[model samples]
Target chain A: MDHKILQTARELIEEAGYPALTVDQVAVRAGVGKAAIYRRYASKAEMAFAATMHGQWPPPLTDAGSLYEDLLALARAFHVRMATPTARQVAPALISELAGNPDLDAQFQNTFLAAEHAALAEIIERAVGRGELAGPIDPTIAHLLLLGSLAAGLYIINLTVDDTMITELATAAAAGIAALADRHHSGNPQGATQPQ
Target chain B: MDHKILQTARELIEEAGYPALTVDQVAVRAGVGKAAIYRRYASKAEMAFAATMHGQWPPPLTDAGSLYEDLLALARAFHVRMATPTARQVAPALISELAGNPDLDAQFQNTFLAAEHAALAEIIERAVGRGELAGPIDPTIAHLLLLGSLAAGLYIINLTVDDTMITELATAAAAGIAALADRHHSGNPQGATQPQ
Candidate 1:
């Protein structure tokens, strides 16, 4: 079944790494014919993408009615995703491997990065609609600020991202976005927080 | 002699990555005996660490007398270090390799992460002294915000980190820090900017 193959693939990725994941090995583990897998996916990249999409993808965020709460939701969701054993094991390797494998890179961007960007963009748009933000903020930059801070704490510094850290990061990010929107909308820094 | 060995090691890392870099290859490229490299460094990781330290370390930041300017200097400095061809080539691999390699992780923390943390800490301390900040802010959180934003912009998005982005990130970080400190000092959000 499709579910069995995806589950088996996820286990293989968690146990070894993406480089060690192969179609034959996955088929053998899943007790499915290699032909069945090939029928579903064109390559290892596609299979891994499908497995990841099915297994560990974060659910889409709903608006929390406040920019701070909305950013917190997204940040917490990202933390949950990155904190997965599979994600922790696979992500660094995937990033390294992506340099040489353009196909994998494109697949990751299309499936993961693009979706993440869209979700964050929606959050920012909702904030703007509620007049919490001055106007549409650059979601890419917003994404960088929110997720980037979490990445540094989790990946670079090897810190445990507890509730306190998440709250602080989310609050600061919301403040930063507000300040940026203020600066962008009005050239003068003083007019940043005033009514439009 | 030492310079040549380090240069060769850097070239190897840039060309074929750290796994392919061996002391023997470094000696051959640098026209030094294998024993010479062994005499200088006990392991390939040590040699790579030294080469990175000698080659592309960011300069220590002097206070520019303002939090915004100081952070901008640090952020810009970080951008320059990351933008190097060798850094672009080796960083992702290095991050992946660090998980399995304790010695490399230690060296990275001691030499690079610690120094960057100290520099940002100094900037925050200076800001406090000038009353630009209410009091000392958490340097770890501050460093995460600044470098995290840069890393996201550079590594993940694969976007060029221009001066504008750097400035905005720095300003937002400063504001974030102020907001955090205010929240820490006073439970209420309204008193954050009013007093300091």
Candidate 2:
């Protein structure tokens, strides 16, 4: 029942701006009573966070021995996540909310930011442990590069409901990120740190 | 004179959204007569496109010997260009307009889209000429990854507005792109194109 409410809330927010969502509207959409929502979330922040995490943040990248392979897969998954029409309708509002709300900001930092960094970090640790990457490369910097590419791929269609371009964007990003990881693994003087 | 009006119009739009800008407001901003704006841009699109180009596309990347070096310079230039706080305020509205207006979209394609691609292509050409990249890496794909990372970096910072994080984000993107390009140059056979 709570899961149904969350999905309904996400749909309402996705259709209307985040600022415009009402618990009443969410309940109506979910076909549940308002009390059900209050039981779960005290305020819109919790509701929106639930909705956003539901909407954003594709799952973690598994640690395939080939870091490039893993990173590329993550990119593909990221694109698939964004391919939803709701992503287009709500992206602008999401940007505004993320920019303005400290609570949401912290939530994002904890959930999306930390998760993304962790996935990339896992790949790096594996590579470094196996002597795949050079000593000079920093995992933090590598994670930033890989995750940055994935994030960029998300907005390629930007607010356009049309997602036909996502596959190309994802494929390119995954390949590019993977290629970089592979090169760094092959003893490049500098890996995705400061351009050669 | 008309060109000057169009340019001024964009600044006005950036300062105040398109809905807010009046012919008189544009004239005042541009230091031109209202008739001049009327003379050139029958509507807002004519004017907004020019102002956006001011920062949308910086000058093209001149061929520096190596793709990495050329892109480093280009990426940094882009960082400074989008760093304008005002761009964030105005970008979404303009992008929103793109969906509704074909003329504006074409202008965007010509100005912002074409210039970035042209510049990236130049870098790729240099790499190919130098035999730095292997037989064939789709230039379009390479272009998207590089631009996507750069775009994503700015969009994330702008949306998140975490001023402290930009430098690291920018650095990571540049490094990642360089690594990606290097792999394109080297051509790895273990590439995973599509996943089941």
Estimate how well candidate 2 is docked, as a DockQ score: 0.23
What docking tier does model 1 reach?
acceptable
* Candidate 2 docking classification: acceptable
- In the range A1-196, model 2's lDDT, one tens digit per residue, is 8779888877777677555778888888788888878776656656765666544565756676554456556655755665454443344345444544556656656776677667666765775575544432443444434445444434432323223334444334344344445444556635444344
DockQ of predicted model 1: 0.42
Clash count per candidate? 0, 3
The lDDT of each candidate is 0.73, 0.55
Candidate with maximal lDDT: 1
Chain B TM-scores per candidate, in order, are 0.79, 0.67
Report the lDDT tens digits of candidate 2 across residue range B74-137.
Answer: 7667656654555554454454455345666666676677677677777766766776554434
Instruction: Provide the lowest-lDDT 10-residue window in model 2 chain B.
Output: B157-166
Deviation from native of the Cα of residue B19 in model 2, angstroms: 12
Residue runs of model 1 more than 4 Å from their true location after superposition: A13-24, A32-56, A187-196, B11-23, B32-56, B187-196
For all the predictions, what are the DockQ values? 0.42, 0.23
Give each model a TM-score.
Answer: 0.84, 0.68
